[model samples]
Target: MARQPVARQTVARQVVASPVLVGRDEFLALAGRRLEDAATGRGHLLFVAGEAGIGKTRLVTSISRRAERLEFAVLRAAAFPGDAEATGGVLLDLAGDLRRAADAGWRDVGHALSARLRDPLAAQGDPHRQRRLLVQDLADLLCDLDPGRLLLVVLEDLHWADQLSLEVIGRVAVRLPGRATLMIGAYRSDELFPRTAMRQVRGRLLSQRVAEEIRLPRLTAAQTATLAGAVLGRRPTGSEVAAIHGRSDGIPLHVEELLAASGVPDTLADAVLVRARALDPGVRDIAAAAAVIGRSFDFDLLTAVAQDAPETVDRCLRELQSVYLVQAGADAATFDFRHALIRDALYADIALPRRRQLHERVARVAVERGYRDEFVSAHFDEAHLPGPAYWHALLAAREAAAASSHREALPLYRRAVRNLPDGSSPDFHATLLAALGAEAAAVDENAAAAEAYEEA
Candidate 1:
C-alpha cells in the first residue's frame, strides 16, 4: 500500500497590538452598508451563525448600534432555550404597535389577522393559512409604518426559536425586498442540526434567494490578544496572552470570562472535559488531586495531596505534561495546570462524596496556607459543612459589593442565605435577604429581587 503523507497543521501567528475590534471589522462594515442600502428601500435579509461563544450577539449589537447612528429604526429580540416551541415570540416583540393599529382598524389585514396573531393556538389547525395570513398582515403593517425610515429587525439565538417564529421570519424576509427593511438573524450553527425546523426554515428562505449567510470563524491568536488588551486596559505579556488564547480557542465569551476571573478560573470546564477524558487512570488521579490543591502547586504538595510516592507522582506529571495538560510553572519545584478549565474538569470528574472530602482536605490546606476567608469558605461550602461557610460568605458578599461586582455579589449572597439555618438567625437571615434583594435589583433581576423581598 502507498503511504500518504500527514498534512501539517497551520499555526496562527502571534500579533501584538493596542486595543481594537479584534476580528469583526469586515463583517460589521458589510452589515452596516447593507443596513444603509435598506434605508434607500433596498431590503436585505442576512444570516449570521457560529458556535455559542463565537461573538454572534456582539456582531448583532455592533450592527444595531451603527444602524441607530444612521437613523435606522432597530428592533431586537432573543429566543430563550426553554421557549424553543414558542409561536410568534419574535413577531410579538417587533409588532407591539400592530395591536394598537389593529384595534383602531388602521389596516384591513391587521384587523383581520389580529386574533390569530394574539392567539397562535387558534390558528394552529391550519398552518398553511396562518402563515399566509401572517405574511400579508406583516407586509401591510410594515408598509403602514413606513415614514421614509429604514427598519432593522434583529433576531438573536435563532437555534432556540420555534418553528412558527422561523417560518414567520422566512416569510417576512421574502417580502422584505423593495421595502425599507433589513432583517438579520444570528444562530449557533453548532447547535443547529440537519432536518430540524430551523434548518428547514433557513433552507426555504435561502432557496427563495431572500437570505444570505455569513459564518463567523474563531479568532486568530493575534486577534485574541487584541481582545485581551481591550479587557485588561493594557497589553498582556506574550506568554499570558498565549495562555488565554490556548485555553479559550479564540472563543470571545471564553476569553472575556477568563479575563474577568480574579484567580485561576474554570469558566470553560464543560468544554475542556471533552478533551480531558483522554487521560490515563493514574495520570487522571494525579491531575484531580493537583486540582484540589490549586491551579498552581509544588511537586511536594501534589505528592501530599495524591498520597502517591514522589517518583510515581513524577511519572504521572511527565505523562500529563507530554499531553500538554500541565506545564512547569515559575520553577521545577512548581507546576501549573495548562488552563483552569482542565483543573475544573479533573476536579469535576471526582464522585460527589469523594469530591466533598477532597474539598474538606483542600479547606484544611487553605487554612494552613493562610488563604483569605472567601477561599476557605468556598471549600467548606463544597464540603457540605455550611457552619464555617456562612460567616465567610457574608464577608465575601460585602467585598464583592464594595468592588461594584454586583453580579458576583448575588452568588455570595445566595451562598450566605443557603448556608444559614432556618429560624436560628432570624435577624441575620433578614439582613441577608435584604442584601440579596438589593444585589439582584442592581443586576436587573427585578423579579428575583421581588421574590426574595416577598420571602423576607
Candidate 2:
C-alpha cells in the first residue's frame, strides 16, 4: 500500500487563540464597521452567540484591538465559575481599568470592594440593595472614566455570569443607547435555555431593543482548510484536510488539535492515545472512562469507574472543569467532554484490560439503571473480554431486532459464531447462522443501512 503523504510540519503551535477568528472576513468586517460606528459616537449593542470554542472571544479581542486604534475607551469583564473572592469579578476588573485610566483616583472602587464588600452583601449596604448599587457604581464609573468619548464594554462567557452581574448587564443594555457606550456580550448558544440567568438577561435586552444578536456559525470546509494551512504554514493534503474538517465539525479549537496530532507516528487515533497517556494517571483514567461512556457521563458513573472516594472524584472533576477539559450539563448533574478530539485521544490510549474493567463496570451500572441491552452490549463489545463477548452479541441482536435494526445486528452474531469455542454445541452454530441469514434477507442490499451492515 502507498504511504499517505505527511501533513506539512509547520514550526508553529496550533493557533487555539481565544475567539479564533477564521474565514469570517465579511462578518468580521461588518463587526469592525459597527465598532467603528460606535467609536464615532453611534454606539450599538452587539451580542455574539455560538457553541463553545466557536471563536466568540477571539472575535471580540480582535475588535478590541481595532477599537484601541480608533481611540475608543475599551473595558472588559470575564465571568467566573463559582464563589471566588471577587463577587462582581467582571465589574471589579473593569473598575480597576477605569481607575487606572482616571489616573488611579477612583481607588475608592477597589477599597469599597475589598473593605466594605468583605461579605457579598456588605458591598451593597445590604443584600437587597446590592444589585442596584452595583449597576449605579458601574454606570457612574463608565460615565466618570469616559466623560465624552465612546466606550466599548465587553463581557465574555456570560453563560457563567452571576445573577448580580446578569442583572447589572441587563440594566446596562437598557441604558446604553442614551450613553456613548457599545456593550458586546458573548456566550455559548447551546447553554441558553428558558428561565436560566443568561436567557433572562437576553430576553430583557431584546424587549428593550438594546441588543442585536449575531449567531456565529461553524467554519466552512474551505475556511477550515485555509485555517489549517495558515496554522501549519503549508497546505494540508486533501485527506488530511478532510480528516481535520470532519473530526472538528469545523470548530477551530478541535481543528487545531486534529492538525497538531497529525504527523505523530501511528494513526490519528494512536496519536490521541499517546498524548492521553502522558496525562496524570487520575485525569487520564477519568478521561478514558469518559470516552468509553461517550460524551456526557454521570458523576455517579465516574465514581464507580474510577473506584475512588467521593472527595477525590469531586476534586478531579473540579480540576477538569477548571481547565475547560469538561463542562457540566445545563439541566442534569452530568459532565460532557469539552471537545470530541479529547474523547478520541483518550479511547485510543486505553489498554484492553483497563477498557474491559471499565466497560464491565459500565455494563453493571447501566443494567442497574434500566438502560437498553444494546447500550450494555456496546460496553461489553468494547470490553473485548471472553465470556461476555458472546453474551453481548446475543443481547445486541435481540435489542437490534426490536429496533428494526437487524441489518446492523448481523455482524455481531457472525463474529460471535466465529469466536465460539471448538467444542461448542452444534445447535448454537445453527442458531447463529439462522439469525444472520434472517437479518441479511430482511433489508434491500442496495440501501445504505444494508451496506453498513454488509461492511460490519
Candidate 3:
C-alpha cells in the first residue's frame, strides 16, 4: 500500500532520538497528525499494520509518548498469541496502566470500574448484551469522562487480540470522533488471515470511516544507514551500513537484534500459525482444545484440557465470547459454546487421532476433578476407552437409581452392560444383567426387561 507523503518537517524529528525512529519519520508524521486530530476532538481509530520486527511496537511507544506530551490519558497493552481471546486480558492491563499512571481521568472514572473488571461478570442470560455492555463501559468512560481531555488507547500485537478486546476497540472507535479519544492499534499484518477477528473488525471500521490504516514497509537503504549510524553512535562506513542492511533486510527488530550483538552476527526469529480460516493461531488452538472438552466447559477444566496457561484459556474464552460463538455460563468459572454446530465446526477441524487424544485427556482430567459420572463416561466413550467408560457409566447408573431417575438409569445401565470386558466373570455379568432387568421392568419396558431377565 502507498503511504502518504512525509511532511517536510516530520513530527518524528522531535521524537526521542533512537535508531528505530530513523527512517520512521514518514509514519511518525502521519501518526502525528492523527494524534493532533484526536487531541482536537477528531478522535478515531488508527491501525498500524506490519510484519513482526517491523517496528510496530516502537511506533506505538513513540505515539504513546507523544500523546502523553499532549496531556492525553494513555493506556497501553499488548496481546500475545495465546492470550488474545481473554475477555479481560487486555482490559486488565489497561486498567492496571490507569492505576499506575494515576491519571486524573482515571480518578474521575472511579475504582468501581476496575473492581468490577476484576470481579467475575454477573451471570447474564444475554451474552450479546453482556459483550455490548463490556465494550460500552470502557468506551463510554474514556469518551465521556472529559471531552476536553484527550485519551490515547494503544493496543499492540492486535494480530493476536481477542474478539472482546477488538470489539471494545471498534466500539471505542465509533465514539472517538469529536471526543478527543484516540485509539491506536498495532498488529502484525503477516498474522492476519481471511475471516480473522482483526481483519473483520479492521475492515468494518475502515468501511464505516471510523478508522484509518497505515501499512509500514521495510526501511529504505538510506534510512537503514541512518538507523545503523544512530545505533553505532557514529557515521557507519558505506560497507558496514550496506552489510547491516543486507543482513537484517531493513526490518527494524532484526536491525536492533543484530546491532545489539556489536560486530558479531546475531540471528533474530519470528513465527506463528493462524486460524480455522480466520482464527488467530493462538485463538484457534484454544478453540480447538475447548471444543474437544465438549459444548460447555469450566475454566479450570478447560485449562487442564487445553494445556494452555490459565490466562490464555480465559482470553480465548473472551475471543469466542466476542463472536457470539460462545456464551459465559451462569457463573464466572464456566461458559457454553453458543451452539453445537459451532462446536462441531471447531471439533471437526481436529484430526481424528488428536481428537481421540484430547478426548482421553478431557475424560481423565474430568474424572480426577470429580465431574459428573455421565460427563466423564461420555468423554471416555468418545476417546474409545471402553473400560473406564463402562465403569463411569455404572457409577452414573447407580447414582441415577439412588436419585429415582429410572429413565436415566436405564440408558446408563445399558451403556455399562454393552461395555463389559470379555474377561469379566459370568456371575459378574449376570449380576449386572439382573440389575439392568429390574431397572427396565421399573420403567415398563416389558419385552426388553423380560429379555434382560432371561439373559440373567
Error of 1 at 121 (Å): 7.0
The lDDT, on a scale of 0 to 1, for candidate 3 is 0.69
What is the RMSD of candidate 1? 20.0
- lDDT measured at residue 107 in model 3 versus the true structure, 0 to 100: 59
**Model 1 stretches astray by more than 4 angstroms:** 1-20, 96-115, 120-131, 263-266, 269-456
Candidate 2: C-alpha lDDT: 0.62
Residue 3 CA displacement from its true place in model 1, Å: 70
Q: How do all the candidates rank in terms of lDDT, highest first? A: 3, 1, 2
Q: Clashes per prediction?
A: 0, 3, 5
Give the per-residue lDDT digits (tens) of candidate 1, residues 1-456.
111222222212111222355789889989978987898888999999898768887788788888899887766655644233234445553454344443353344344444545543344435446546655555555455455667788887787665556665776677677789898999888877753457778887878788988899998999888898887778889987888888888987677656644443445664444334555567667777787766667797667666677877888788667655688864568887764445766777788888788777777776777655566677788888887777777776776565344554677788888898655667767778999999889767899899889887
Clashing pairs in model 3?
A: 84-162, 85-315, 85-316, 86-315, 86-316
Ten consecutive residues with minimal summed lDDT in candidate 1? 9-18
Q: State residue 223's C-alpha deviation in candidate 1, in Å.
A: 0.7
The estimated TM-scores of all candidates read 0.51, 0.54, 0.54
